[model samples]
Target: MKATRQLHDLGQSLWLDNITRSLLDDGTLARYIAEDSITGLTSNPSIFDAAIGGGDAYDAGIHAKTLAGLSGEALFTELALEDLRRAADLFRPVFDATGQVDGWVSMEVSPLLAADSAGSIAAARHIHHQGRRDNLFVKIPGTPEGVPAIEEAIFLGIPINVTLLFSCAQYQAVAEAYLRGIERRLAAGLDPRVGSVASLFISRWDVAANPQLPDALRNQLGIAVGQQTYRAYRELLASKRWHKLAAAGARPQRLLWASTGVKDPSAPDTLYVSALAAPDTIDTIPEKTLHAFADHGQLHGVLADDGGDADAVLAQIAAAGVDLDALALKLQRDGAAAFVKSWQQLLQRIADKASALEKESQLP
Candidate 1:
């Protein structure tokens, strides 16, 4: 059996952290689902930016939308939704087969609104309503500003994928926000089972710390951070507050490992995927990493529920002069900014393409 199937059978969900018109049209995504045990997918501005900007696959749609007088962010979102809605439908079977626990596709709100909670909330609602798929999740960053937006969106029954988190504390905070949202739903006599996932970034931790840590500590920070966060996840699920919410028909807001692609060429390609497997959690992996895992990844063991060795690893990093808390905040901010930059570039690319296509169409 493929290692991907092993990991899935062991209880962790494998989500393809990418989507594009080509991948969907070419049967790559479907094959991953059918053979590699991939149960879900995730998309961000960066992914869509690369997808649309990297190829001509979306040119026809871009031309149509442009001819229809849509451009900029509005135009970009319509194109993105076209891809996501199709991906969502492809995964609907897993969603139904698993009774809503698996097969989710995530679409993030604009990164430009990262600091604007109200704007983020409104965009999330609009996207959720526009997609009109229960398997779709509106991804919100887990930054301080975004936490409130996450809560509000979840309270409104929008399935949320809390993105850009970097620390155990960050994960806990987002999980708490999700629980509060469910509690509110129960209070308002709404169903409490609105789905959510807190996406804690993994490989970026090591990427950020690689220059600062010694050779011995290289490529270890990401796994350590995931370990620590996994401990918090297990604790939260076992807590009384979560139990109350779970009994009230709510599903646990799962932990999702984001940014799982190995950045260091010297590191094992499957380092993050093999080491971070845990029950009831989701790992959204980039395409390269996903293919690498399917090729050579091994599912040796599950992560210790108590976060074995994570504290020691983190302490060593601190002793080596890394302040994790400060770095976590910086990563979250930088991640939001990076997405915004990618989003702007994507919009510009779409505008350029739309203009060129419009000129061609008028040449008739």
Candidate 2:
């Protein structure tokens, strides 16, 4: 079997961390679904920025929206939603087959709202409603401000993908927000089956810490962090609180591993994919990494329910003078900033494309 199929069979979801109009137009996304066992995908400002600025594939859409008086973020939203809604339809079968646990695609809210709880909540609602797909998740960052927005969005029954989490604590915060949302639903006699996922970023830890660590510890911190968080995830699933919610018909918010693409050139291309395999978790793989893993990735057995030597490795790193707690916060903040940067670039790309297209139209 292909390695992608192997991972899927082992119960880990492999979601393509990419989306482009070309992928949908040329059937690549569909092929991944049909052959590579890619049940879902997730997109962000960076991904959309690349898709919009990379080629002429989105030019026509940009031109139309521009002519229709849509520009900047507004234009970007219509363009993104067009792709997401189509991708959501393509994954509808897997979604239905798994009872909504699998075959999900995510769309993030404007990173500009990262610090505004009210704006985040409002954007999530508007985006999800505009998306019109039950399998679509509107991504909200897990910042201090975003936490309340996440809880409110969940209580409002909008499926959420809580993004930018870096450590077990961050994951737990979002998890608690999700639980609170479900609990609120139950108290109000609402259905508790709201779908959500707490996305923990991997790889960035090593990218940030590697320069300071000894060679032996290089590239190990991310997986260790993942292991630690996985332990927390398992414990939560087995917790009395979660059990109460489950019995009351609330679906557990799944843990998704983001930033799985290896950043170190010396590291094995499939390092993250091979190291973090586990049941009931989602790994959002970059297109390049997804192909590499499918070609030659190996399963090194599933992650231990107890987190294996995660703590020991973390201790060694701490001893080496890397403050894990401080670093997690830094990474989350950095990640959010990076998204905002990409979001700005994306809007500019749209404005530029629309202008050029309009110029060409006038000549004709």
Highest TM-score scorer: 2
Could you give candidate 2's per-residue lDDT for residues 254-338 as a string of tens digits?
9999999999999999999999999999999999998899899988899999999999999999999999999999999999999
| Residue pairs whose backbone atoms clash in candidate 2 | none
Candidate 2 segments whose C-alpha is farther than 4 A from its true place = none
C-alpha-based local distance difference test score of model 1: 0.91
What lDDT does the true structure give each of the candidates?
Answer: 0.91, 0.95
Q: In candidate 1, what residue range of length 10 has the lowest lDDT sum?
A: 241-250
TM-score per candidate, chains pooled: 0.99, 0.99
- Model 1 C-alpha lDDT per residue in residues 3-114, reported as the tens digit of each score: 9998989999999989999999999989999999999999998889889888899999999888788889888888999999999999999999988999999988999999
